[model samples]
Target: MGVSPDTAQGLLDELFLISRALRRNLAQPEEGRLLPGGISVLVNLESAGPCRQVDLAAQIGISASAMSRHITELVADGYVLRNTDPDDGRAIRVEVSSTGHELLGRIRESRIQGLQEVMADWTQDDAERARHILHTLRSQLIARDSRNAAADHQKHSEERIDVQ
Candidate 1:
């Protein structure tokens, strides 16, 4: 009665690919200036302030080692600065450099311009509705994850009681 599982998956993958291609083509950023991953890290730091490597990695959905490597690259690029964490003397903190902020601002403006051009024909109401739907979808996903976690916890508790 509804869409088949395979068909649904195919549609989702196709849409993701199309969106990635559009972003790549639309954002004609300067060569060797900044990539999407670096920009993403910068934006997160800007919002969350200086963060530990592991914290940044988790927030960015990356592994701790991978985050360290990325942070190394960022530091080398002069876009990110590193310092000792005063609260955790053994750990390090990273913050976006002034250059990084400037680059992020430029990227944001460029992306906005590209999006505006792409949706030039769409009405403001349409944009607002799209934003609302996107927020709703995100919320729904968070709720689903929370429910799944609760279910898993219950199963684990049941197993422990049975063993006891």
Candidate 2:
């Protein structure tokens, strides 16, 4: 007897539109070309301290080969530096370049501007309440996903057998 499913879907649709516009606005000011995935790798490297490529892939939710390709581009762009892992002779690690850190700062400011505009009409209290709700929603979603991922993966694997 609460909100209808159709109304919920309409809300989701509006959220997507807002998110897309925000992303576009965030990407517009950056002079350098770093795709979202590539910038993500930079951020991970900056925070995670030069982890092995395999571990970075898992942390970033991308395949190892795809991480390699992304690293290739990031290195070529001078936003990342890769080296042999001193502790592990067989493994490689990557770190964000000084340039990458500088760029990340700039991009972060640019990204926040769009979000600020979206909330321009809201009072400080209203913004705080919205942030709390979003954080709560995200945490709940992550918990739910962790519980369901194994079942979903197994179901996909079973479905893949029929396709093959």
Candidate 3:
């Protein structure tokens, strides 16, 4: 059954609240803690492996210049390594360094501990159900976004052809 407008709006509100809370909680800067964007870059690099900076920026929905600055800081901090792409000498590929992996592990553990404390009253089943629902919702949204992006690209291509 289709979700009612009220239900949809409620879901959106809850999602926004959750996002804001998480960001606020995580944004507390410590001596070793990364800024949110740097954390995102490290996480993506760790998950997706090495790729060009431009592609990484696109995947993370950031401007290329912003990505460059993040990468520069990460490299300077010894959290990430940048090397020339083997296939394209002019391009650079970034990969998480060993230090980055250690930092990510610590970050994950810290987040998990915080979550456990927050959900101390909840049962394991409740946590599992929340995880499953959130995962499903995220997957569906990503799929829809991919489809829309592809359609937009095709339309742009057709426009270029017509112009020519």
- Top TM-score: which candidate number? 3
- Cα-based TM-score, every candidate: 0.78, 0.77, 0.89
Q: Pick the candidate with the highest lDDT.
A: 3
Q: Please, what's the RMSD in Å of model 1?
A: 3.4
Q: Write the per-residue lDDT of candidate 2 for residues 1-164, one digit (tens) a residue.
A: 87799997997898799777766666745544665577778878888987788888887779989988988988888888888889988777888888878888888887788678877899999999988987996798778877788789999999999999
lDDT of 3 by residue, 45-159 (tens): 8998989889999998899999999999899999999999999898889999999898888878777787788899999999999999999999999999999999999999999
lDDT by residue for model 1 (84-149), tens: 999989989999999878877887888788888989999999999988976896798788978987
TM-score of predicted structure 2: 0.77
- Using TM-score, rank the candidates from best to worst: 3, 1, 2
lDDT of each: 0.80, 0.81, 0.87
Instruction: Give stretches of model 3 more than 4 Å off.
Output: 26-33
Q: Which stretches in model 1 have alpha-carbon errors above 4 Å?
A: 1-11, 31-36, 146-164
Model 1 TM-score is: 0.78
The RMSD of every model to the true structure, in order and in angstroms, is 3.4, 4.2, 2.0
Clashing pairs in 3: none
Off by over 4 Å in 2: 1-4, 150-164
